[model samples]
Target: MNFAYELPWYRKFINESDLVFCDGFGVLWGAKLCGYCIKSDNRMTCPDYIENLALACEQENISLFLLAGKPGTVDKAIAKLKAIAPNLKVKGHHGYFEKIGDENEAIINEINKFRPDILYVGFGMPLQERWILDNLTRINAKVFLPLGACLDYYTDAVYRGPRWMTDRGFEWLTRLVIEPQRLWQRYLIGNPLFFYRVFRALIASSWKNYSKMSKFWRT
Candidate 1:
């Protein structure tokens, strides 16, 4: 949602997405702080879900198509997933092509031909979401999951912090420390902005509710 504040296209894509669950611990925290009764355990990161999802796909005979990371990274992730769930049928293509023109069309065609039951796009935030928005209608998949950088984590290309840090919601801090140069602006600046927006929205919601209550009593 912080990205949504500045990126109108991202906001629109998120609003249009069939499923927009809270993947960030900060988002879950903000919802709880604003009086939403969401269980902490109910909040899931992509890596966490991927572990279970692979097993479920194996049992259910669901096919998967992975799209993300540099050249070869998706292949490594696919190998690991196959090892974990040998029964799982999966294919993948790296996410390093021109966003427009023939290359993009070719990639979409490849995915459509594969006809995966689930398609996971992990080409980072707004980029992944934008790609989905652009080609979602043309993609032949029962489910489209915008995984951000989860594929990197699965391939061990990126560290998602230790279990302790993640369980305590300090994963962002760990990531900031690990990739300060690349991610400082995102975690350092964007986090505070996200919280501020959440606070303002919470206040607005409370005020609207109070007004409705007062009007109902008066009537």
Candidate 2:
């Protein structure tokens, strides 16, 4: 939401996505407030479904390429994933390289060489989205998935709180507690701002409807 609010291009990117799924409770609540019938079951966090996805990919013989996390995080995640789906064909690269010039070109060439069926890029929000938008034509992957900090959570590099809290939509609170210094602004200011925007939009929509009904009654 913060990304959408701050970056017009990011919002456009999401609006134009082939498919978008709710990853958190905030989005579900916002959609509900907007009169959309999104439910808790619609929320699909990566940590919760990654193993299942990996197993399915293995069974379907789909290859995956992970491009995110710190130097060792991707490898750790791949190891854990392979344990669950031993036959899963997957490769990974850390997300520390430059996204331009020869380095970026080389990275693109590497990915093209692999020609993975699915590419998971997780350098966090707008960065991942922007990278994909800029390189969509150059990349050969069939599916491009942007997952923020997913590798960190998958490899236990970052604690994802307890299942009870995460499942119930209090994961943001847990994250705020864990990385208060780094994430204070994101949850503190961003959460309220998101809901405020939703409510404002809802009110505007209601007013528009009310005006239309008033004219219909007068006629």
Model number with the top lDDT: 2
Clash pairs detected, candidate 2: none
TM-score of each: 0.90, 0.96
Clash count, one per candidate: 0, 0
After superposition, candidate 2 runs with Cα above 4 Å error: none
Mind giving the per-residue lDDT tens digits that candidate 1 earns over 1-219? Answer: 777889888888788877878888888988898888998887878888786899899999999999989999998988888888998989999998998899999998999999999999988878888888888889899999988888888778888888998898898898888899989999888888889888898889999999999999999
Model 2, range 40-132, lDDT digits (tens) per residue? 898998988899999999999999999999999989999999998999999989999999999999989999999999999999888999999
Candidate 2 vs. true structure, TM-score: 0.96
Tell me the lDDT of model 2 at 182.
Answer: 91
- Show where candidate 1 strays beyond 4 Å: 206-219
Clashing pairs in 1: none
